[model samples]
Target: MAAQYDAVIVGAGFGGMGAAIQLHRLGHRRLLILEREDDLGGTWHVNRYPGLAVDIPSATYSYSFEPNPHWSRLFAPGAELKQYAEHVAEKYGLRPHMRFGTVVTGAHWVEEESHWRVAIAGGDSVTATYLCTATGFLSQPKVPDIEGIEDFGGKVIHTTAWDDDYDLTGKRAAIIGTGATAVQLIPEVAKVAADLTVYQRTPIWVSPKPDYRIPPRLRRLFARIPLAQKVVRAVGSGLLELLMISGVVHYRRLRIANRIAERYCRAHLFRQVRDPELRRKLTPDYSFGCKRPTFSNTYFRAFTKPHVHLETSRIERVEEQAIVTADGRRTEIDVLLLATGFNLWDVNFPAIEIIGRDGKNLGKWWRENRFQAYEGVTVPGFPNLVSLNSPYSYSGLSYFTTIECQMQHIDRLFRAMRARNAKVFEVSQQANDRFLELMRDKVGDSVFALGQCATANSYYFNQHGEATLLRPTSTRNAQREAVRFPLSDYTYA
Candidate 1:
């Protein structure tokens, strides 16, 4: 079967869904979504790991336009979130526009016509004038490099891509890596697993989630008086802004936040782990903000369980029935779990080479000269291509805020092109270069570059060793910067 559309969106996450809903509302009727999973929720659909839930308040995490004041709790569980995404799709009647269980492996731009020839398996193709890569940052799972991984006889699970049939009850489990996923899983798994050994490469600073069930009456009140919830969100967002403000100015507030986090961690450490030697070993050496700060309601208490063991030694390798640490200690377990997080800065679309004007391959161009996008959506050589959660656009606030801004900018970009009967709309090389110059010079000095962070493997930094991806900034500030590169900044041929 052959199909055509004005735009092709990849991945069905918050970014892709936001694009679809907004574009459909804006009168782009012929749009198609390619999703690898059978379900509508991208990350939420896949990660069925135990005790998975959002850290942010449920009221603020949703779409601002389609507010769901019916959240059951302050932070929603994964199942609730999955159902929420499905509900949004149903409400917007977006199912017919989606193609589920289809994996898009590659895409290329046909230079003359300026259309994207997206290639998928089974010798299928769909050509569209505009391509939107909404494959969000967390879609790809990153398993760490471990020796003798194949030798583990018991079932192995990755938190990002989980197996629902994995039964942890009465099982001795050796969990590797203590990132966000591990923090959530530890408490749940400790309840059932006979013995739980959590391998921590470095300790992470965590705060009480302050989460609770939102009663129906309160939810109804939120729906009616959304301003109250909005104010709460604003206040929380403002608190986060201090980190960016201080980091941007190289002020002492950065140190203040760091000291506060350190003190909190110490309090928790002494409160939970009574052994001074273990507490010292578990303490982190780097600053708190350098890593993605983890929030948990019961993560610290989970460590206090008698059945739970905290292993600090780096894993040497896996044997048939045990995990061998560097100290030659063997931790025998019935299952091994990987809580290693996602590949943050990895480009989602890399299989197909895109050739633009001057016949430059996209990958080669990006490698030779770093990815240059005006507002991190439109590229200099590529015409009519818009990406979501794209490079350099990862804000500290909600993704909905950023995507809506990008979509609005894209709409303006295309409107400008249509008004002028432009054959191609590509950012001028000067505009692209200037954007990168601002990114590295003006923006990279923020708290996102916490060189003193404990979790040193964060994907926020790019190849140039600069933190250009995730940062703390207000929606107004981000949109202002994004909308600054007016459609006129791009050469419309």
Candidate 2:
């Protein structure tokens, strides 16, 4: 018999697991999860760099329903996070429904039957009524297009797809791009490598993590008083929210705070660096909040090490044994690490080949696109398909809140599927267009639009210089939508 499911979830990350768990609790079966990797934990499984850690505090970073009490660190490491995803899968008995190592390369909408025909890389196709794409932003590595890269006689690795075989124990290392990955990785690389060099194009604002471990005594107390831990989590989440609210509402205040942070960083961080010009080279020219702010206690101080060298020259090309800069300089390395982030926007729409009404390819249709969703999950025309962290739905806020928010809207679409007994559901195109305009207009008023930050070329911006990648909706507003998905704005097909 053909495997027909109510929904087919792609990727076994927290988003997919959460969707499956919610459906199971709602008593909906006929669900299958397809994961490309041999394991779960989408980003967590892939990113195994030395200094990888969660940007958000782990207290509120987890699912609200199944909070882990035994989190060893405040900002959990990659391994711990991967374990968290697996634990959730096991705890909810979600493992049975998944087919690991199966990649759903393409999903075609069968308009005649109103079902999605999903194609696995090395297996038979499956038909699903609904398709959920959770292939996260960080899944694909953004290796820069530099000439002579293939000729380099060094072990090259992207932070997204780490090559664990290469031993960096005593080798000279070079890390390209000083973004989020570099912020965490530099300190760790400094510890192991005989000598390390960080090649830079830009600098990111570094802030203190305030990260600490969960003491066993505190864990015991929390175990005894569950509500107390919940209270603590709530308080921690509230503090994070307060920070977000202040940053969003008052752009200037956020800018000033970033400047203060930069000053603090220079005084406490860069002051110890003996070379004044080198210290200046390390400072960022863009507004701190323009690009994503990174947190690390030792990222700046890593430069103070005698073994670590910070290079500011533009990488002209890669040679067999060395990197050639624009000024005819060569920096040799035994291993090279690309801290560059994944490709955004281009990954969505046409890349997935989502052909909607009348053979319309989604990517081509929106040449002047603005990321808009009626509820941050559903698009006007693309019905029965929900994005995990779709546009205007993502924020620098906790992924926990954003994922939960998206899931709520998705639940509404699910309910509508049941309530009307409808074969397919889609957002009205007119509604999406208007919402898209509103999203662009709203974001145009923000600091990111002013180009005061380093995000000018970062994935943070869409072609129109708007940040449609992340959901900027406040948590308070999103929770209301999640509690009950609003169906009024969307038209059922």
Candidate 3:
């Protein structure tokens, strides 16, 4: 006999926790949260590399329902965020409902039983009436396919899987991939390593981060009046919405901002790096916001250091000792750091074989249909299943914005189900197609579609070269649409 649950949520991270909290509040009983890891705080717990911090402002990154007045810095560190996750779990009594160290390997819809039978690792199974996968977009870490990568005798570490025991001090370190993680880790690695070489595949647009600690006076005021924190978050969100509109959505409208951003980058590069040649090498040729934009005040400054060297060449292969370049230059490295990002659009889903209607694999369906979801929540064939952080479902600069919107959407669907006395809520294929059509129309005008995103080699695009990852709308529009959209779009049975 399988343990039964009203709802079974996957991945106890921000998305999972948020879903659990919302479901519980909405009167869901016998809900279970299955976390693969022994603990919660999914991404925050895993990526513990040096100098790791949230790029977004701390004020906006948090949930609107629960605002913490005691964030130590404007850009909170990984540990603090992890503590915050634990705090949320403890605060809401979510720990009791969570089954840590439990991995859900597969899920099959029991059409006759009108429930989902989930197969777990270690020979266990569970049944749930409602299934919500909050597995997250960036959950799976992507390692580059390079020859002799496994043959490396030295310590080769990915930023996602940081070995706390491994020391980088006085060792010749080489960091591959100059994306967000590299931008943060390089400066910290340069501080300790004897010599550091940053191998850049593509130059990314990095803006200055205005990060500082919140004054105790302000914290006290936020604690005294929570509205104060809400106001701050609202203002920041508004500003970010404008950025998203002009820079991301309107596409061509970002010319002015692009000029300003490039100027700022050039000025910052000039101020930080002494060598003109190095500065030029660091400068990006692509337009701003082509790929995911980054922020770091110290990354460029790290290059000014004598021990740091920037190598922008095709990596020939990964030898036991050195990373050889196309031009036949080999740099000896004691520690190899891979800042290579996640498997975003490449079958990035819950680590479970989900068999929907008629034994249709959700993974195969997604790949076949180009990853379409009805409002990024429900698939046509997957009855009573909701996916948080799904493709084209994700919007807003802050993930909290996306989570909140998703929660609202889920709440609406739940309310609809109750009102109609529906046992199943599956979106119609027509509805899903219409939603994708709208997204396609909106994305056509966005920088991701019209801009240099294709050449930028961004994860925003799938293997099919379609920009279906991000919701092509402003945060406010996305939120409003998710909440107020027509429920008739889905079929209630």
Q: Write the per-residue lDDT of candidate 3 for residues 346-430, one digit (tens) a residue.
A: 6475456788888888888888877788788888888988888677987877888889888998889889988999868888989
**Each model's lDDT:** 0.74, 0.74, 0.85
Model 1 CA lDDT for position 479: 70
- What lDDT is obtained when candidate 1 is compared to the true structure? 0.74
RMSD of each candidate relative to the true structure: 2.7, 2.4, 1.5
- Highest TM-score against the true fold, candidate: 3
Find the candidate with the highest lDDT and give its number: 3
**1 or 3: which has the higher TM-score?**
3
**lDDT, residue 143, candidate 1:** 77
Quality of model 2 by C-alpha lDDT: 0.74
Q: Model 2, residue 271: what's the lDDT?
A: 47
Using TM-score as the yardstick, the better of models 1 and 2 is: 2
In Å, residue 162's CA in model 1 sits off its true spot by: 2.0
Across 282-379, the per-residue lDDT of candidate 2 in tens digits comes to: 77777545666666788888888889988888889999888888999888889988888877766653335565555655566655555556656766
